[model samples]
Target: MTVKYLICGAGPTGLGAANRLMELGENSFLVLEREAYAGGLSASFTDANGFTWDVGGHVLFSHYPYFDALLADLLGDDVLTHQRVSRVRIAGGWVPYPFQNNIRHLPPEERWECVRELLPGRRPEITPANFREWFEVVFGKGIARLFMAPYNFKVWATPPELMDFRWIGERVSVVGLEQVLKNIILARDDVAWGPNNTFHFPLHGGTGEIFRRLAARLGDRVRYGDGLARLDAEKRRATTQSGEVIEYETLLSTMPLDLMVTDVLSEAPNAVREAAKSLAHNSVHVCGVGVAGLRPDPTCWMYFPEADCPFYRVTNFHNYSPNNVARPGEQMGFMAEVSSSPHKPVDKAAVMKHTVQGLVNTTLMRPGEAEKAVTAWQMDVEHGYPVPTLGRDAALAVIQPWLASHAVFSRGRFGGWKYEVGNMDHSVMQGVEWAERMLLGKPETTYGA
Candidate 1:
């Protein structure tokens, strides 16, 4: 079969392209997804015990008005708006998030140390070479050592020194020295800072519901279980695992670009393959625990920087929406995210045990409460986070342009290999922009295309 546009991966990017094509009154496109469902990493699932858990801690907050309109139209009254209540577990106490702004909660000595570092005119004047230096320069040594360094290490699963700071826009909270001093002096908390401070979520079916609805709207254009097995860029043909061959005028791939170049394209250039090796990413392990009692706190999520916990972040899934639990207002749910890479390997088999212990260690659960908590679900996503390593931009500079020359647009979280534009809204908009560029001659501003 021949198609005008043969899109790979039915995740947000692919769906975005397909949706835009339909909007333009075109039906010459096809979306192929390996999974039986859509949503990619944004997907969600319900456990055998009836508690719902996302792939990780996914919350809906968009920077684009188009995405906001699309979601508003799709979800309508089924959306639940939430005010983010996040905290950090540190020094045996809970500090309001943006840890730098809440030094008043730290011990006397530590608080004094942080204040002393933040005192007038201590800022570094040199340019930061990497994320580590950026953290120390942006936040003083006390806050960097206390939270930023270890916490970021746990999340990225790579040394801060090896990653780039360009992708830190809005993702990391930066505060002025005066604001820090004021908060410390007044003993006040500054918990609200960041785009996701107010977000929305589906009232039911977890985060995956949005994509599931999108795929449903697209109808038969999206073919699940038909994943790309091989591609012949010269012939403009793709072979699926089921042995069906397809020819396309142009291909838009949302698969991991590394796998696309090295594994799928048998004749990819050696330089592109070598550049793919320089890209770094971490795998994520999600563990969901269902407790028999109501939620203990109203907090949405908590971060852990200490070694006592195996996971970096934990989300109170039950609090995101009441319908997330099998028995609303009765049973509660918690989901923890653990990141692993070559530098930080994780034993998958022991993840459950370690996660349960981590819950107790971080005081999310009591020792006796372990008996009342059931392991609802556990999942390992091989490409959880696309790291912004020091060499990432240089590598993408080599890979993306080459693929574009081959009539392939690799765009998405892992496909584009840009963590700054890796959010759900960004991923979908990348697809829309790619389709617009292909069908309407529009230039993409999000990915700098």
Candidate 2:
């Protein structure tokens, strides 16, 4: 069969493109999703025990007003606003988020160490060549060694020496020695540092609810369980796993760019394949720790730099929404994320057990509260965070243009291969912008080939 437009994957990016196409009065389009359901990585799941868990710690905060309006349209009054109350576990205590900004909360000696490295002559004078060096040059060895280095390595599962530092942006809060000392001297906590300081979530369902609603709005236009298995870009044709062949005028793919180029597309150039090889990604294991009793903690999420926890971060899912727990305000749900790659391999079987012990070790759980654990629902995602390695942009430079030349726009979290702009809002906008680019001849602002 033939269609005017064909989209691969039903995630935020694919749904965003399809929705924008409909809004632009284009209905002769179809979306093919491999998953039985929509929402992709942003999808949520309800465990056997009735506890709701998201793929990971996904909070909604958009840089685009368009995204805000879209959330309002999709979720309406069902959304809950939250001021982020995040913290870091370090030196056997909790310091506020942006660990460097709140080093004052550390023990006196530890605080002095963080400050000592930031002093006039402590930081290196050489230009940073990689993420590791960049943190050292900017944050000094004390803060880098304490939080930045270890925390980033845990989350990315890739050595910082192989990663790029330009992607830090707002994701990593940068502070000077003057400001760091000022806060420590005044005993102040800089909790409100990032754009996600205020965010939103669905009150009933997890983060996936928004996308589920969007896919429903698209109705029969979305075909689930039919994944794009093969694509002859030259002929503008796609073959789904279910053996249906679709000939499209334009193709928008939200699948991983590496897979799209190496696995799906036919007769890709050697350079493109090599560039795809250069793209590295880590796998994420999301373990939802459900407890029988509730705690009065207001902490949204906590970061773990210490090796005591197998997971890099854990979100207080129950606090995000009471409905997230089986018994609303009576139960608790903790969602922990552990990233793994060749450099940092994690035993999948031990993640949940280690995650629970991590909660206790990090003081997130009280003594003997381990027996209160009811459900340890987990989901292992093969492609989690797209590591922004030193070669990423150059690799994208090679792969993206080739795909675009073939009337194939691969745009999304992995499709774009840009972690800096790979958030939910940016992911959706990348699709929206791609649709605008295709139909209206508008320049794509969110992501570019």
Best by lDDT: 2
All models, RMSD in angstroms: 1.1, 0.9
Q: Write the per-residue lDDT of candidate 1 for residues 1-449, one digit (tens) a residue.
A: 99999999989888988999899888999999999989899888987878888999989999999999999988999999999999999999999987887878999988877767666667566799999999888887888888989999999999999999989888888886788778878878998899999999999999999999999999999999989999998889999989999999999999998889888986878888999988899999999998888856989999999999899999999999988888999877889999999999999999988999999998888779888775558999999999999999999999988888989889999889899999999999999999899889999988888
TM-scores for all candidates?
A: 0.98, 0.99
How many residue pairs clash per model? 0, 0
Q: List where candidate 1 sits over 4 angstroms from the true fold.
A: 120-124
> Clashing residue pairs, candidate 1?
none
Question: Judged by lDDT against the true structure, how good is candidate 2?
Answer: 0.92
Q: Work out candidate 1's RMSD over C-alphas.
A: 1.1
Q: Candidate 1 clash total?
A: 0
Cα lDDT for residue 392, candidate 1: 94
Query: Per-residue lDDT of 384-448 in model 2, one digit per residue for the tens?
Result: 99999999999999988888888888899988879999999999999999888888999998886
Q: All models: lDDT?
A: 0.90, 0.92
Could you tell me how far off, in angstroms, the CA of residue 289 lies in candidate 1 after the best superposition? 0.5
TM-score of 1: 0.98
